[model samples]
Target: MGEEEVSNKQIILKDYVHGFPKESDFLLKTSSTIKLKLPYDSHDAVLVKNLYLSCDPYMLNRMREADASYPTPFTPGSPINGYGVSRVVDSSHTSFSKGDLIWGITGWEEYSLITDTSLLFKIQDADLPLSYYTGLLGMPGMTAYAGFYEVCSPKKGETVFVSAASGAVGQLVGQFAKLMGCYVVGSAGSKDKVDLLINKFGFDAAFNYKEEEDLNAALKRYFPDGIDIYFENVGGKMLDAVLLNMRLRGRIAVCGMISQYNLEEHEGVSNLFCLVIKRIRMEGFVVPDYYHLYPKFLELVLPHIRDGKLTYVEDIAQGLESGPAALVGLFSGRNVGKQVVAVAHE
Candidate 1:
């Protein structure tokens, strides 16, 4: 089929976000035929057919205004952007070819012209599911690996606590901590997710935060001896509760704060004073800084995946039409695992 005959469907941002994003925040539109061939005159660009798009909590932050402290915001009336797996259809860059498979930042559309080819990573192994690049083998995977090993500095036999335990990065963090011989406990919003964390991801113990009236008491029950490492995903009350239960000289890896994301005023972490008394180390991290260790991460994780020692789950929403609902579902704890939008069949 000719490229001119292929139409592209796109999801464009409505405008800067206020409190929380709604389905109306995006508009689905179709574009004319895609250009199969890259213009020879153009430098360092590649055209790709998107296969899968990731729905992550951090993307919500990007929808806000670009403050001096925050990263750049998504442009109004433009295609909403996120990490996706794609097949290169046309290229003018030496690093990638026309048929190469890649994963990186791409617009929420059927086709994308990646102006910065350097951002794309070539897919060398397809033995694993290609859709994994949108989740476990992609951004969330790196986030789990870097935040756990790099920031948390876990030692075998240490007690670990992960909030939002059944979600993308949290699931993997629990598994990685388990494999490291740590006693891992996780907290989820519902019974189903808590069960998945304990039974599927091999967490030593799991709890439904919704069932607990006192989060601090729940944490105390989970880690009677105190937690050596805490993976912070849901912040606010959960974080404050975790602070009260943290062991002396403990480490806390701040991967995300889903609880505080939609709030008009950011919630205060009242127990931060525990850091001083306990001499604990709490650090916030972004995954990209440790991209250099991706190869090393693959070396460690791929074997576990191949041997069935590791398990990854995805809550995939088929078609671009489901994109808005899938993204919104994260806030309500509707998705059971790593929420993804399967935009097309590769």
Candidate 2:
């Protein structure tokens, strides 16, 4: 596309979310003109052509008001921001050059002016599909690595349970746990996802959480011994049930609470008192805090991927226009794997 032909299509927030977000909550609009060149005097910034965008559960929290307790919310009528892989078209930044591929926080648009260039990391391994940066090679991958290794601190032969096991992060956590010689079990919402966990990701066992009449009983059935580490993805009832089945000095890494995200009021875990009885340790963490270790994470996961010892699955939406539906699908288990929207190709 020539400079004159460049145009920007953006997905904008329509309003603050009250309950579960719908497609109507966003408005897709196009700009009349999109400049391929960065402003001449601009310093430490790069203009990028966004290729793909990630749809993650954490983005749901940003749809609400900017409460003092949580991170800042998305501004209404503005383009929503998330992790994306992009190609630099113009640069006034020293660290990046034209045609360099990068990934980090970028707007949901065809083009974005990234002022904080430090946040973007240059893509070194183009041998892998660039879209991998949206999930397995990006934030979700880092989340699974840090949450499991740094937070949970697993040991061999330990029993680990992951909720939302077929989703991006949960799937990786389960695989990583298995590789560490742990007896790993995961719970997903559907029979198909359960099969993916066990058959594809090599989980020791998996069950459809929806079919279980009693979550505690289901946990006991899967881990007849006891859960030594729980990689929490869907909180609420699953967390409550897992609490009852934890071994002494168990570890819980609170990565996400997807079940509670869209509720009118967050559900409380009634069995949290089990933490005291079992001497369990529970902690919550964000992936960005561990960004410094990304290079190290790549060194570990990349080899596994190359050797076919690790597998990743993605559910891709075709264009920027599909971003709204893809994002809203996360809450309803509408996405089969890591949900991503392809905006443009380099």
Candidate 3:
């Protein structure tokens, strides 16, 4: 058992995609093999057996040709990599040891040889579901925390509007807003997701965006006094609608734009004048910028989780073979909540 070779199944991106991605866009190779141990001279490198993988909308951008913004696109012939929960099988780094549970950037394969340990974070509390690290306790959770408290600078009792409100980050934003005594409303693609927002996440109000013919009017009906904070997740038309409905001195934290990710030409928003007229402040944020506060964020959220003041939903697809479809489903709004691919039990 010292150094064993194992069959490694991997999900590889076939090529750069032009539009909405299909399952066929990925190539699943089951014949790959990886050693259970790191090389003798391997320094600062660790070999891990992946447990769970996150399927996020931003991965679509990474599937495109490398550009200034997406400089590190997935290599066509290599395994696709994203945030995942893994167990260390072998480690040459002092920070990690064998059998350590961690969540960070890892490959879309059964086993990953992580040479870059900069992003890796060890899981301190193994009692909490390890899969939560893929969503609620991992990158998406931090994104919501930073975007809401840090970027938006929300005040209690303020009215909040979150788009793509049932997804990973948006769902947490809604709950965080409610915990702050803010009136929170969310928009989702389906009625079931809308129900999840209102019933499950304690959103003040929720709506199915697909059923609404006019998004701007829909927002106006719900937010009579106007929105104080807008957690921007879906861009394009949704942004335009939210822009018109925003209150004076409103703050917009732009976390993601899932709606426009697959488009050849991103849809234009024609409401720039509203920002200046209303004296609104809108800023974009990346979670890494606030990674330093991870410990502090956990301190605030962990208690809520323990006390049942917060709830997180996840749509899990089983096996490494299901990875491609699960990743593609995110763009189409097929997933109910945070989409995760479960590769192994432990």
- Candidate 2's residue-wise lDDT over 120-168, tens digit each? 8899998999999988999999999999999999999899999999999
Q: Which candidate ranks first by TM-score, i.e. highest?
A: 3
Predictions ranked by TM-score, top down?
Answer: 3, 2, 1
Query: Residue 182 lDDT in model 3?
Result: 98
- TM-scores, all models, native as reference: 0.97, 0.97, 0.98
- Poorest stretch of ten by lDDT in candidate 3: 66-75
Residue 165 alpha-carbon offset, candidate 1, angstroms: 0.9
Segments of candidate 1 deviating more than 4 angstroms: 1-5, 31-33
Candidate maximizing lDDT: 3
- Off by more than 4 A, model 3: none
Query: What C-alpha RMSD separates each model from the true structure?
Result: 1.3, 1.3, 0.9
> What lDDT would candidate 3 get against the real structure?
0.93
Encode model 3's per-residue lDDT on 184-274: one tens digit a residue. 9999999899999999999999999999999999999999999999999999999999899999999999998988888889999999899
Clash counts per candidate, in order, are 0, 0, 0
Q: How much lDDT does each candidate structure score?
A: 0.89, 0.91, 0.93
